[model samples]
Structure formats: C-alpha cells, structure tokens
Target: MSLPNDASEDRMQMMTKTERFSKLFDELERCREDEQMQKMEEMNGLIDEMNEEELKSIFTIELFDKIHQIIEEKTLPLENALVLLKHVGYYRELKIIYLESFDYSLLRERMKEMIIDENEKKEEINEKILTDLCECYALLGEDDIFGEVLSIIVPCLLKVALKKDETEEAQKEVEMALLALGNIGYWVEKESYGNEIKEIIKYHQEHQNLTRLAYQSAWEFLIKRFHNYESLEEVFVNDLHFAREARREIEELKRDVDWKRKEETGKEAKELLIFRKWIYNIDNYFTSCKLWNEEVEKLLSSFVQMIREFRDNSKKVSNWCFFSITNAAENRNVKIDDLLKSGAVDAFSEEMKQSTLEDKIVYDCLYFFLNVSRRLNEKKDDEKKEAKRKSIKRKMFEWIEEGYEDVMTSFHAILPDLAEKSKFLQLSKYSSDYLWSL
Candidate 1:
C-alpha cells in the first residue's frame, strides 16, 4: 500500500469508509420522515378500517427502528428524540429495544430530558405534567424512577403550596404530588427521600388553603406507607386527626398486608410477623383515636373466621387499649364523653374490663370515669324525656364518681405521693361552656 498507493486506490478507501458510516445515517433520517408521513396516512386510512389499536402498534415498531438508528447516528436534537419516545406505549417498547441494543446512551439522554423538562415547567404551570410524571413514576415502580421523580416533585409541590397566590387547583395538585411522594418514599422504602417528603407534607398541611387536602393526604400516606411504624401508636395517641384517618387506612391496608409482606419478606417467616406488629400498633392506635369500637368489631369478625388457634394476646391488647385512651385524654383536652357519644366508645369498657389490668388498663378505667362525669354534666332536662334522661344521667354520675374514687384509691395505694404529682394536676376542669355550645 505504501509502495504504490494510487489516486484510485486512495479514493476507493475513503469512499468505502464514508459510505459505511454516512449511508446508514442518511437512511435513518429518511426513514424518520417516512415514518411520520406513514403515521398521518394511517390516521387518514382509519376513517375506513378504523383499527386504532392496530395503527398504534404498527407505528410503534416502525418508529422505534428509525429513532434507534437516529440515536446511534446522533443526527437529531435530544428533545426531538424524546418526542418519539412519548407516543402511546412507546416508552416501554423503547425500554426493551434499548436493552437489546446495549446502547444506554439514549436512556441516559432521556433521563436528562426528564430533568430538563421538569426544571423548565417547574417555574410555570406544572400541575398536569407533575401529575402525569407521578403516575408514570408510580406505575414504573422502579426505585430509580421513583427516587428521581420524588426528589424533584416534592420540592416543587412544596414551593407551589407555599406560594401566597396559589390557587385551589394548585393546592389540589400539590396534594396529589405529596401523595405520590408518600407512595414512593414509604411503599418503595426510599428512606433517603422519606424525610424530605414528610417535610413537604408538613409544609403543605401548614398552608391555609391546602390544610384540609394536606390532612387527607397525610392520613392516606401514613396508612399506605408507614402503617407499621414502631411509633405509630405514639403518633396516633398524640395526633387526633392522624388517629381518626388512620382507622380508615388500616382497614384498607389489612387486605394487602399479607401479600405485601410475602413480596417484601420471603423465607424469613412464612406468614407476616409484621401483621401482628401492625395489629399491636393498630390496636393501640385505634384506642387512642377512639376507633376501637369499629376496629375491635372487625377483629372479632376476623377471629371468628379463625377459631381454636388463637394467639392469646388479650393481655397485650387490653394494656394497649387502657393506656392509649387514658394518655390521649390526659395529655390532650379530649373528652372521653365526646368519644363515647360519637359511638367510638361503644363496647370499649366491656372489652377493657375483660382484658388484663396493666398500666394501660388502668388508663382505660380512668377514661371510663371521665366519660361518666361528662355525661352527668350534660344531662338534659327536657320535659318529655326528663325522667328517662335524668335516670340515665344519675346512674352514670353515681357509677362514674364511685369509679373515679376507686381509681384514686388504687393510685394512692400504688404511689402514695400520687396526689403531689403534676400528672393529676394536669386534668382539665369540665368545660360546661364548651358543652353548652354543642
């Protein structure tokens, strides 16, 4: 070659290289234009045959090749490339195609495109895009996608929720975004992003326009994601709204908890140990929130279905019930009477009395007396129903005052200096004014 490289030989070698590289690239560009034209023709032809699904399927594969080639050639803008990926069901197909070709450059570029699009729209109206993106992220259920979308979505929703000029629509959108983040962060175990999502949720709930939505969303999130937190009982006892909302969520979560645990914990335990922990937590949580009447009723139904092989955890259950209600009332200004009248207190006393007499049980006893005192104070004197109401009220106060004295006697026996403790001092005086308003 060095000895006698003629002009023809040199020209041939150069042409061969150029032809090998440039020919495919030119064909790719032409194929893309053809694909676009064919799509339009297909739409027009649908006026007769009208096979929309078939038309979409046909175009999807055709465009995939064209876009793949274009990507390899690096002959188009990244945004334009992403446009082809966004067609109905195209992204999933592209996922398989890219995996086969072993060309991840396109995927990497797509990720970049997502980031760019998110940033650009974040400053403008992002409700639709963010909602769609969250849907995609949730459907994908891949940690990478979930984490990526959640990181941006939480902050942006927080920003929008905090804006003074934000609309109700914007607030609703923020709720959806927060819900999405909670799903990914909790269900997917993205602990790295969980705290951030929690913070954003707290912020959204703090905003005036979105408080109701935020409460609703936070309620859903905890049930869906952190229903099994070790401190769930504490949270339910301390937070009234959280406790009430948790009751609804726990009902829904119970159905899927076994399957979810099977997926999350294989071979560790055939059945879910987490379910028992959940029950333990929920048992206490429901008591704290005054959802025990409903939850216990559900538990009784479940127990009926699986008889004779019971776990004999009534002691734990009783203790939880007693402490949760008592502490909830003691710390907060919550009246046990209101809880009872709301129908949440039905059958709870009976359940507590039958259960073990732990510290938690003692708390329930205290609440029972509180409820009786409250009913006594609110005894109505209607002329038509006076005798019946008064009879009920008199018995309730007698029972309640006697019970209160008994508990105090027990407290004095257990802790002789109990009267000097600040805990008893914290009991709020009966609010006749508030009761009258009701």
Candidate 2:
C-alpha cells in the first residue's frame, strides 16, 4: 500500500543530507553532454539552499576522494569539479583534501592543452573554465603550488593585462588573472619576470588599462613581493581612523541610525583597518624596491592618485605618499628622474606656495626634496648619472627662477617649522639650506 501524500513528503524531508548529496553526485557522474549546464545549475541551486553547517558537513574527505576519482577517470569535467570545489574552498580542511588528492601536474597539463587551442577560440565558456581552474590553483597554492602557478600564470596575466579591447570577457579575464597573480606572486622570479611585472604595475598608471579591482590587484602583487619591512609602531595611522569611526558608529547605534547605514559604517571601519594599512605599507615596502626612475615614478603617480581621493584618510595619506616616494628614491640609480621629467619641480613649487601649508605636509615635502637633492651631490657619479642628476637640479632651478620671489617667499613661510622640526630631521635641514641656495 502506498503512503498518503503527507506521509511521503515527510519521509523525503527526513532523509539525511549525505544520502541526498550522494545521489546528486551519481547524477553528476553520468550527466550527458547536453545536460551538463543544467546539472551545474541544479547543483548551484542545491548549494545555495544549504546552510553553512550542512555544507561543511557534506564536504568530507570521502566526498573529495570520490570527486578525485571522478576527475581521474574523466567522468566529470575538470572545470565542473573546480566549480564545486570553489564553493567550499575557503575551509582549510577541504582545501587540504584538494591539495593532497588532485593529480595537479596532470591537471595542469590538461588545462595547458585546452588553453593552447582556446587562445584562438572565442568561447566564453572555455575562458570561464580556464578562469575557474586558475582560481582553484590560486586558492590552493601552497609552497610548490605557488611556484608552479607563478611560472605558468604570470605570462598569461600580463598578456591579458595588455589587451586594448574592453570586451566583458576580456575584462573578466584580466581581473581574474590579476587576482591570481596577487595571490601567488611571491614565488615570482624577479630577475626573469620583473620587467613584465613592472609593465603590469605601470600599465594603467597614466590611463585606465585595468578596472579598479585589477589595478589594486596588480599593486597587491608588487607590495607582497617587497614587503621586507614593517612599521616600527604596531598601529598604523589608519588604526586610529578605524577606532574613531567605530566609537562614533557605536554611539550612533545607541541613538539608533538606519540599519543599512549603521552596518555599512561598521563594514567600512573594518575594511579601513586593513586596506588603509595596505596604503601606508606601500611607503614602507617601495622604499626597499627602488625599482628605479620611470618604473618607480609611474607607480608613485598611481599610488598618490589613489590616496589623493581617499575618504577621510587625508592626513595619513599625505604623509605616507611622500614618505614612501622618498624611500623609493633611496635606491641605487634612482633619482626620481622621470617624476622631474614630468615637471614635478613646477608642480611642487606651486604646492609649497599654497595659501596655507600644513607644517607636516611641508615636512614630508621636504623629505621628497631632500631625496632628489642628494642625487645632485653624488661624489662618484658617472657622467651619465651626474648628467642625469644635474639635469633634474637644473629643472628645479628653472622653475624656481621663473617664480623666484614666490618660491622664496614660500620657503620663508615654512622656515620656522623647518627650524622647529630640524632637531629630528637635521638631514632635511640641509635640504632646506640647499633649497635656499637654489
């Protein structure tokens, strides 16, 4: 006798999720070519409905082992497995299962084969498949994995980063590849790939070659590789920013603000804590990079522009921007020549002459001036280096002479603050003296 409808529905609801998912895997294993997309859609539907606990419970070692077997047998498409893996890739437990189980070398070989043909093809789905694989490798990249990805993925990312066209697929390709490179870029061999990496870093500086996310990721890779130092103070200027916002937000919540605005404020505060740290750290790291002249100049241009538009982080941004540039200027053969070539002298002269100057900004500006000024005094300079240095100093004087009175008056306006701060920065005192002489 068949059970009544209510009883049958109750039985279906009572079935264990593992049993249900097991059957779903069975279907995935035998899905026909025409049904693969629909199957993925269905799988996503199921995945969406699963709670965190249920999802976590479902992705066991056994499940990954089964998926691994399917991949080895070519039952499920590699990309499909990757799509499934990505859903739970954030869990450390599951990530290890993937790392240990997948025959990565074979997987890479297969992907390379497909992509070779895929280059000439315009299939978005193929691009998506390649993209998904890249994410999996990026998410799973540990020691050896990071090295492998750095080698194979860097060239592809650079090629896409240089695409002049703005097709959606092309843009997505660039974004994904940039994000991958950011994740695994520490393994990059700076000698072999440094020039191309520089191209990507500077590619979008003058004009927009990358979207905002891609631009941030390109710098992310650069900062990650050169993160050789940390702030002497454990707390950053942004930490204070975060704290003030948090306190203000909490007070607003006590008085009751709109839920959306309150939550957004909280989110912004947290993000500020991290992303802003990244901003100031650029100064710390780039000082060590000394990528030199045009490369360094272009990056500084990009970085300063980003912070120039920062929301509520102005004081720190102003100080950090020049501090980092000043450090970057310290490297061998680096005189920030390209920046001067772009007429930084006139621009800075005008800035210093602003109606009211913050002594702090003036202090920071002094450091940048000090850095470029040192190049003019290098004792052992080759004629090429000396010529380069002299040319920069000549440009500064030209700007100064053109507006000598205004420039001198601007220097006088800050002389008191420079004297006050000189106890801490006697070197900058010398720069002040040098500027006065000019």
Query: Model 2 lDDT vs. the true structure?
Result: 0.52
Residue pairs in collision within model 1 = 322-360, 323-360
- Which ranges of candidate 2 are over 4 A from the true structure? 1-26, 42-62, 82-135, 146-150, 228-438
Tell me the TM-score of model 2.
0.42
CA error at residue 232 for candidate 2, angstroms = 19
Instruction: Report lDDT (CA) for all predictions.
Output: 0.40, 0.52
Candidate 1 Cα outliers beyond 4 Å, as residue runs? 1-311, 314-356, 379-388, 394-409, 412-438
Q: TM-score per candidate, in order?
A: 0.31, 0.42
**Best model per lDDT:** 2
lDDT of 1 by residue, 312-406 (tens): 42233334434444444443234443444443333343443343444434444444445444544454568655565566554434333224333
Q: Compared with the true structure, what per-residue lDDT tens digits does model 2 show for residues 1-438?
A: 566998865775676654565556678877875576566665554554454456657655556667667788888877677766654432322212234323333444454445444544655436555556655556444444444444555666566666756778787667666656665556664445556655664555445666544655565565555553233112212222222322233233323323243245422232232343345445554555423333345555655543343313344544555555556555544455565654444445555566686766666556656665666565444778666666666766665645544554456555666768756654443324445332
lDDT of 1 at 369: 47
In Å, residue 438's CA in model 2 sits off its true spot by 40
